[model samples]
Target: MQDAILDVKNLSIRYNGASEDAVRGVSFTLGRERLGIVGESGSGKSTVGRALLRLLPGARVTADRLRFEDVDLLDLSEREMLKVRGRRMSMILQDPKFSLNPIQRVGAQVAETYLRHFPANKAEARAKTLEMLAAVRIRDPERVHDLYPHEISGGMGQRVMIAMMLLADPDLVIADEPTSALDVTVRLQVLNILDGLVRDRGIGLIMISHDLNLVRNFCDRVLIMYAGRVVETLDARDMDAAEHPYTRGLLAAQPRIGGTRGPLAVLDRRPEWKEGSTP
Candidate 1:
């Protein structure tokens, strides 16, 4: 943790007039490694990621400590946050169709990040954009750069999103369900590209996902969330050894190859599970 890029402690978020918190007392430190957050829908996994980036609108975010590198994110004004957002940290959204501009060419959108952060000439930004497109394993970077978001396949769009987010070489990247929209083969390809970037650049990655199997295979550590709290944290390889009943139920619910066919087990909800416990 001495080389931690992001340190979050006692983080919680709630929308105005909401009866309960969406995320409560979640705490973790991220180093230059892949960390996965997994849970069912409405389990507050994405909310935690949004809170780290201050992307949740009209929501009250509070934390005893939420520091990215040397900067305190909670204290920075909205104007100042703009500088930190794409330069030091970036987010890859769930769907590129919604995140990317429909009208703008792909290369232009990628170059926009470079132009915003650095005082580079137009020619220089274009060169960097092409270089990044190639880095993400896009076939024929020159041809793909000229295509619009709609013209490319889902897999290519996600890779473009990765290329855009990593244009400035951020220290921490929060990817929220980045591969959820792709097919199996494409999903693995996208994961490979993301993994390569994180490893080669030594950047911290927070992958918010609902796929337990993918996280177990792709991430270094996993955080099991329930309701609004982190119920358990363990090495991704040791997910099968999870002690919490909620975690156990999730593993049971997953369909296994060559296993007996039966109805998936339902997660038995418990009130005590939301009592803000940490592991």
Candidate 2:
């Protein structure tokens, strides 16, 4: 963590009227590397990412240390945080169908993002926007730029989302299941774009996903969450050697290609596992 971009220690969160904490004692430090957060739905994977950007409106969030680069996230006002978002930090949401503006052309949405962050003319912003679209491997940036969100395929819309978020060259990116809507081929292509970002731009990336195999192969480090807590942390390559029962159960639960003809193993819930788990 010599040049860490994000640091969170003992981070916990609860909803407005939750009976207990939804996320508790989750902590990790991120450098210029791809870190994956994997868990089943409702495990708080998305919640932690939202908490970093103060996107969770009525949730109670407490952390001993929540620092993005040199700025303290908890101390920033809404207006102050706006300068950080879409400029220094950005979140690539899961679905473009809901995330993108249905009425506007994809190019204008991306160009508007660039204009908001950088003081540039419309022509200059459009040029930058096209560059980003092409960077994500869109075949015809000029043609697709004019299409509305409804006119594009899910995978194409996702690429547009990526193009928009990356327009400003943010220091850190939180990608929540970025490839869920894409096909196998498109998913790999999108992942390659993100991989290029980490390797070439040297930016920190947090990939939030429930697909263990995807994280294992794509990310450098892995954090396995269970019941809103990080039950284990390990290098991506060492996922098979994970010690936590929850992690092992998750691995065992993955269906192999032509290997498992029987039902997948079910994860047994244990009370002790949730009481004191930490990464």
Clash counts for the predictions, in order: 0, 0
Give the per-residue lDDT digits (tens) of candidate 2, residues 51-120: 9989999999999999999899988999999999988899999888999999999999999889998899
Give residue 59's error in model 2 in angstroms.
1.1
RMSD of each: 1.3, 1.3
Model 1: lDDT equals 0.92
Candidate 1: which pairs clash? none
lDDT of each: 0.92, 0.91
Worst 10 residues of 2 by lDDT: 270-279
True-vs-predicted CA distance for residue 255, candidate 1, Å: 0.5
Colliding residue pairs in candidate 2: none
Residue 240's lDDT in candidate 2: 93
Candidate 1 segments whose C-alpha is farther than 4 A from its true place: 276-279
